[model samples]
Target chain A: MSNNLTIALDIMGGDYGPRSSLPAAVEAVNLIDHLTLILCGNERQIRCELKKLDALTHPRILIEHCSEVVNNDDLPSSALRNKKDSSMRISLDLVKSGRAQACVTAGNTGALLAMAHYVLKMLPGVKRPALISTVPTQTPKPVYLLDLGANVTCDSEVLFQFAVMGAVVAEQAQNIDSAKVSLLNMGAEEIKGHESIKEAAKLLQCSEHINYIGYSEGNDIFSGKADVIVCDGFTGNVALKTCEGIAKLIVHKLTKALNKSLFNKFLALLLFPVLKKLYKRVNPDQYNGASLVGLRGIVVKSHGNASKKAFLAAIEEAVREVERQLPEKIRYKFEEIINKNA
Target chain B: MSNNLTIALDIMGGDYGPRSSLPAAVEAVNLIDHLTLILCGNERQIRCELKKLDALTHPRILIEHCSEVVNNDDLPSSALRNKKDSSMRISLDLVKSGRAQACVTAGNTGALLAMAHYVLKMLPGVKRPALISTVPTQTPKPVYLLDLGANVTCDSEVLFQFAVMGAVVAEQAQNIDSAKVSLLNMGAEEIKGHESIKEAAKLLQCSEHINYIGYSEGNDIFSGKADVIVCDGFTGNVALKTCEGIAKLIVHKLTKALNKSLFNKFLALLLFPVLKKLYKRVNPDQYNGASLVGLRGIVVKSHGNASKKAFLAAIEEAVREVERQLPEKIRYKFEEIINKNA
Candidate 1:
């Protein structure tokens, strides 16, 4: 009801702290009109950065002082329990209390997920929340992959719900109507994977809510065969990480190959522009943020190593979620499906 | 004994006809010393291709006539039952009857696996046969990832044995004296994955036959953190496919960027050699074959679309299996582990 999109950001999260978060927040504020930010962290550090920004002051940027920090090595549950005034916890509380429309954090993923589940609660009929991310595909647009690393072990029902939720996100966020949903399987065959996936396939096949394309092999993910690829968190997590590792390896090898000799080095100099574009296309930071779906309030989890660009993108993603009213739409769809089936 | 390292190949298995298989067999024979081949397929087509080869008269090459071909579309069970005189069945029988040291197939992977399991039998103490494939790591050496697409659902005991078998293969093939084995998990923590991986991890941690390296994430697979990565076939298949898909996407994107403008095209021409070398390094054909570990007889399965190079590599892999006595070694190791634990 505030008439403006306000995002509560955990300024103390990620590797670079307020130095990255403040710049990212400022960049996001400048990019989006009618936007406000509540930067939650130690007030002194935020104020120091804010002083450096000579832009005309607007009431849009506010600071909520938080006294504690959650280090990466801290046990997620212990951190959530012990650090009551931690920046991440405070940011989530802001969304939960309706002080902010959405929450953005690059803190401990486990802690963020736990706090979100405890505070915002799952949507009706949603058993658990799924962390969904997008990877730029060879298609004309990006493909959204879900359950990236949220719940490692899930049943058929969870997978079916993930498929539905992923399709909804793709339809609203990526502007892809009738998003094709495919289950990630070992092979394209009907009888190629674990029991849960087979059961999920049966459910998805019967559902009219989605454009349930049949099974897709891993190679088909980036082939643009489907707009949304759904799987349990374990496999999805591994797939995402594997893609990242391979990208890094490719870049490292290319750099080494380029520097092997004088001719190659000169070629590298000429190819630097195109190679840089290609590298940016595959960089995880450019696509470093994911949304924790199935919760009552919007929560965006940025990568732990996220830089200014990635953090800002995460804030923009949160703004998009608020603008789209993703939670309300999700609720309406789930209700429609459940009532229709009933 | 024939005293020849002869292999019987199923010429009718893969997507292409004897066009690919026959040439591949000829190429394999040229590389392996004192090696012979029994090309099993329709009599007329085999003879026609054989006549095209200048070395057909050499004592090393022979042809086994098979009346029927196993179609990829045929059901695995039905193919095994009705295709009695099929090339795939006949080739397996050649290995079983001691007429050939091993059998190589690029046919229907399911039917090939079924035939190998039904005919050659499992190594003593191996409850299930695992399809172990080599993945080229960022390092100069390759990492052996097992249960790539074999058993979709496996118990803890089967995974524990897979780790041992994979370790042995990596040691023998990569010439690594101490093979480091790691269980692929969603995270590096102990409680990160399902119950099966957790139990498997406990068994592997105390395993005496292999160098157990605890847990590894998907990124660790390419970092050379472990020489052998063990997982259920479901996860392994997806992970491997994801890597393939991502690599292809990177290459595809690079191709696009390089062709965008004249200057980029010039750079591409200058860097063509290095780019080609990098492409060759990541090509699926370079790591094309999989070994059916835990089987009593040596069986190597190649990609259905394998070119002459991949087929030749499959033949070489079978030769290595014979030289290393992989099956016997696996049986001994499994028996030792079972006995000690019991």
Candidate 2:
């Protein structure tokens, strides 16, 4: 690897493609002193954006051209089986080949995951890679929730793996050494949940290294009672999207509410600064990156609809993970557990 | 069976016990013209609150005292097996004995459900009861979501039962004569989900009466795409609370954001009406009542922390359910479906 931390960017991915990715990559390079971004996409398109920014003179950014792009509608299997030269795959290859410390993508979620799994494999104890994202909590710090949409029907072992991975991320994101992990259940009861959740809770409680709190209800995710929450991907995905949808619904409803009368509209206009700040606080784009944890390499997935600023946040997330040497740390943690078992 | 609809309320339940329920009952009696409330709890305690409200002289309010109180810590099984004379059970007993058309409570959910099942029994062809609640949607009307926390591990048959029950509620609550129903899944794909959900989808698709749509993701609950979204209680409960948690987190975080500067605080004060309107629109307590559906009798469970107005809202929910004869309508729908199948 080069001396500077290198992050591979899938420039042709997401809705805006290079329009969003290139600007984010350029900004990221300027933000980190020793950072080099391997921007993977069509060279002509990349050059056009670089010319606009007069950034062709920048030594830190390199264009790694890939002809094919993974379309959002393309199945993950199609991307894995057919699109070998696609930017999403080529970018992951850079990480696997040690040319880059990490890879960031705003591509089709399923395709990126399938390609990442095939290219980098998985850590020793992890059967399947999990998708984790930071959620704002009532406390000063945000909590990490894992398996957001990765394993739809996670078994007991996979859920336990999520807890371990979530705990690790929580430690990295927030400086909590022993993050209290809890299984998200229907209720906060020993008798609640499907068999897999109950079984996972039993394992977590028995583990001495992790601070395993029993079961937490969905509300507890924001309650700041636990640093990490583990759940099956199906539940996690539903919960994540539901939160986003409700936020959107509230905004839409509020606009309608405010415009009901002329007095109210004037009141709302006067309150615009406060409302804008409130909107910024809960904006999903602000927390744009989700770590595809458990792969042998570090990969961060940005929201497909991420703005340039939001995409920059994702790039920063990848840099943070790279700085922490997240994959190696996870490997060491797994090895320690294995040694303890032996 | 009575000339006026009578709803039995367990007064000695919930966090504030008689304080919340008694005042709610009085408010409800004044709100609904032909409504009668049977307040079931300790006679002395009920009378004390009644005397304060001069509700003892109110012809619409009836006090039925029970000796025992069911604490929130009381397990469902313990409540069912031992606490037969507890206020929760006694209240349900009124519904069973044809004295009350419905029952309302702000008590421990598990105990209330278990006792209700034992006392009122299930409707024909209905194997289990599901907890149903109305959640605000993008549409003018709120959507009905079932099995909020009733059956953690629901089978295909149970999910189908939820559909039938949900459809009944939607028909009663909203104008759509045939409510479009969707099964909640991790994704919108037919391939995504646990086997039980897949099987439920198959059953719903084949059913003639139900306008069964394909799988809907978490966001669809607020998308106004479906009139009823049915899932296993665990998933539904998780999704419901996650929405509530995110709403709470946003409100909390927004308050912190606004107070950052005196100028911002002043703007917040100017925008107070807009903010208060937004808060009221998404207030959890405003939509406090969760109907326990698929039983022989209607029962509404209010949030334990419900304010007096919220508790009154729960009584209104019970009144609405009674006015429509929700249980009878569900019975007819089930019978029609069963007959069609046969």
Candidate 3:
């Protein structure tokens, strides 16, 4: 591990803005002795939040004031053209300029993708950057799902590349020697899915570097059959959001069931601890960070409506990626593949 | 339904075949006064099951012996050609020949889709049939999601057709006058999804019959924002299966949590009723029927692993569609749209 590391925090991004990011930044700096956070946002607001948290005088914390903040409703294209001084843009710029080893934001996903791509660019031999996150499964270890709304439509080669990048993350991030990678398809049959998927399967099957498994259905995602599940952005986005929706529905139904009567409510108090622990295990907030991998630099995206803990998790994820040298490892893998193919 | 409604049951389909379907068939006929079932499978097994249920001599129940059965692993095209005398095919043929008003099968989905499409054919101007099923939402009424896995990739026109078909099912099935129809996209923005989604949105927006409510994200599916949500089969399949996956995960987690200690186990016993009710409400087994809409005849595809109760629910759903004359209604809607566009 490096003796010292710096990560840029987009404090003005996300729904809670400085309210969530400031506390997370304070907690992060306090937890990691060798860490420094360059807080990117409105200087006055960041300072105010820091003062409220009683961490304004922390030695390792610095603030870089950004004049504009990217709105959730902003178009990615427009945000790229304009909003040059947005907290989101400045955070990526810091990573690009080598002032920070990584960046974390809980901002507009589309805008963040656009700005990060333009600012940091793709790693050599990489077609595109993918949004990768870990989803809880039946086993103790979670499965890594990728292309979560990065490129909406990935062709055969892009999908194969996602498999490679996803494998690297699963291997390095989770310490798996050979992560079993699977292509997410409508069915497990060889003839299922679009032609692109079939072609991608062929590509993955022939790869010596990847421990590629066969296809995985949506239900198999949480079965822990595969260490990494890869799909196009549209499918991945819907799958991830569906998980979020169902979790919410479960919580809602459970709450309603528990609150029906006074006697039941009293019983609920006794059962609350177990339910709370289960909720924490499956909660989307706990798995907040989705890194935009394949970029030249590390960029971890927290949930837009992130809580302080979720944002803090995002920062920790960025630190881990930096320590693992994720981008450099991916670049080397791709280079080896290119050389082998040649 | 009519005074003497006849439906075909594929007793040799699904994982358990007659073990699940025979009991469901017997119960269905006993539950509905005028409903008659033509149970299609091996005569010996059907009679054996019926005798065990003490329904061997029921007047409303009849048996149509089939020599073959469709396996879940069979390819769609091969199943269509090779399994012509299969129980699944005989059931659909009964519907086609006017011997049955509807057909229910807990068989291979791809095979059923292929056979149904080939036998009944599309309603006059409808492009393709879609697998439509209701998903539980926060509101009292569930939303209808279409193209679950029938067509893997839908173009603009096919997606628009799914919207029309989904709306008809939601309107007639749920008795809503103007069911709110929405195009499912990755994001709820104008420029968020693929071009086909945008074009489908334009078509839906201009439709006089459809109460089109712009775009809906995956999270909004369970938010009760739209009564009918339309998407390509790939996306819908992933979303629906993801729902199933999360529900299973929640149940698994809750069961584990409740079984941790003796005190928690006692609490679980006290909490069993409410928890069971919640599980039933969210259980995919309870919502087993997915009708292949936009065809000339009614066809309900139950879960391949449906329990007796779930298979019975599929029978009930098929009866409901037959009574509603869903195909006729869908045909009328498409005719009206064609005339208006002309």
Candidate 4:
């Protein structure tokens, strides 16, 4: 709604760093008319990249020089304590200070998560922040899966909170009216999974705000059966990464099969575009942004080895979340649940 | 390597009951010369189905004539307690009584797991039985993934035991020596995953028998980086089912794409066989037998909705395990480790 929608970018993050982020920044500004990007990284490098892209003089792009960079191998605690001036931290800080409405990073996930949690903090009545991402399903719409390596182990209440947050995300981000949510379990049976998951299901069932669908198996993740699927970070991470692995395996298998014969080679050429489109649809990296929800402010995480297009997608996701006022909606939903309980 | 190898089949199991199992049994007996199958189900039904295939009077086929059947919705505890005469339990009983070298079933996983554990019991030094299956990887050889909904939660010791068992299966079943074993985690980093996984990594590293390849993320499951990958049942189940789901989605997506236009439809006809082959290779149901290892006798659990070919595949898997003496190998490995620790 605002004319000046500022988002911060951690240009010093990811494997390629400025090589990907700078171009993504330029593309993002060109794509979104009302968007302003605060590039938080090395001043000299940012200017050089911007000048090469012919966006150096662009009024929408602002540079915030940061001296340190968080290495991929750096421990999250060490990154939090030592790398305050790092681009990842600075981008989060911009969000904290209201200089930016949201921040996007293709940085080390642990470092970015720690920095965002430290800088943005949690929303009222939220115990933890979850990494929620839209995964392609069998249906036309993608389903939301949450707690993707945020908190490895969660109790019933934490999972309940995640379900609420996921519902808000699916509803607002996708503009769906009453998003059906489900707990990711070992089986669809009510007696399945760990006690915590079963307890979370009971809690979700009682909540009138959430349209709590029954348990969803991993097979159900991409079946488009539920709008939002909630699980512990470990399970969610495994499921998401398994999706990545399977997509890669499929592409690999299909390529290998197509490369077998001369006639098949001819078929490959004719089918290349369709196959490429299919790969793009299924490839998790192409949909790179996984939002850190339940925080006071928005933070979108791009993949560590994200391409320029993927980084831009992350920026777009942050813009979407910012426009939707994600945190505020989550806060209001939580407040509603709390008041009802009281 | 016995001239007379007998295996029991739970003909009353699965959705189709005798429909699929009868054909699979006929196929298995025809495929393996030394194989003798004890059909455990309703005598009249088995005779009626086998007569259709002209296999009722086959010399190698014998009927056990169990009256009861385990329903899919039956609780594991109740099934184990009440369904003593059920075909699933009778198959396990045949193995326990040394009447059959191995047992194959396409029953309710929970019920089969419970009955198998109850009747066959665990091998000495084995903490728990795990469901291990081969999944197609990028490599020519498929990798073995274990704990597929067998044990919901596993501690360090249980995981360590699973590693030992998984290694035996990968090495013996695939005819590979010193199979590279990896613990499935959220990240390859030592610092990542839950504490149990990290501790399991340490235990695995200390073992001389196991070729312990540190951590493998979910994406590494089918990367062919490790020969055998182990995780707690919940994670393993999700990952395995996720593979099933992805394969279905890919098939669904490709079919929809092919159906789009006349030109695409023409191309689809040529590519149909290749895609079918790819689907068969990747489809978890095709490679349906998930062996319940760490038990005294071999028990291969086929998919509940297994086709005749898939059930035949399970029988073939059981034959392979019987030939290789999988349970004996696992027992010996555990003994070697225990003696070293002592």
True contacts kept of each: 0.81, 0.84, 0.73, 0.85
Give the Å shift of residue A275 in candidate 3: 2.7
- Candidate 4 scores an fnat of 0.85
Better of 1 and 2 by DockQ: 1
TM-score of each: 0.96, 0.96, 0.98, 0.99
Which candidate would rank higher by DockQ, 1 or 3? 3
Provide the lowest-lDDT 10-residue window in model 2 chain B: B279-288
TM-score pick, better of 1 and 3: 3
Cα shift from native, residue A301, model 1 (Å): 1.0
Candidate 3 residue pairs in clash (backbone atoms < 3 Å) = none
C-alpha lDDT of all candidate models, in order: 0.84, 0.86, 0.90, 0.91
Cα distance off (Å), candidate 3, residue B7: 0.2
**DockQ-derived CAPRI band for the predicted complex in model 4:** high
Error of 3 at B208 (Å): 1.2
TM-score of chain A of each: 0.96, 0.96, 0.98, 0.98
Scored by DockQ, the top model is: 4
Question: On residues B184-222, what C-alpha lDDT tens digit does candidate 4 reach at each position?
Answer: 999877898889999999988887888998999989988
Task: Flag the better candidate by DockQ, 2 or 4.
Answer: 4
Writing each residue's lDDT as its tens digit, candidate 4 over A1-342 gives 566699999999999999999999999999898999999999999999899999999999999999999999999999999998999999999999999999999999998888888889999899999999988889999999999999889999999999999999999978889999999999989888999999999998988988999999988988999999999999999998888888888889989999999999999999998888788777765566699999999999998888999999999999988888999999999999999899
Query: Clash totals for all models, in order?
Result: 1, 0, 0, 0
**A1-342 in candidate 2: lDDT tens per residue?**
435799999999888888888888888888887999999999999999998988987999999999999998888888899999999999999999999999998998889988999999999987899999878788877778888887878899888888888888889777768998989998887876899999998888889868998888887788888888998888888888887777778878877877889976886776666666656555553356789999999999988877788788889999989888898888888888888989
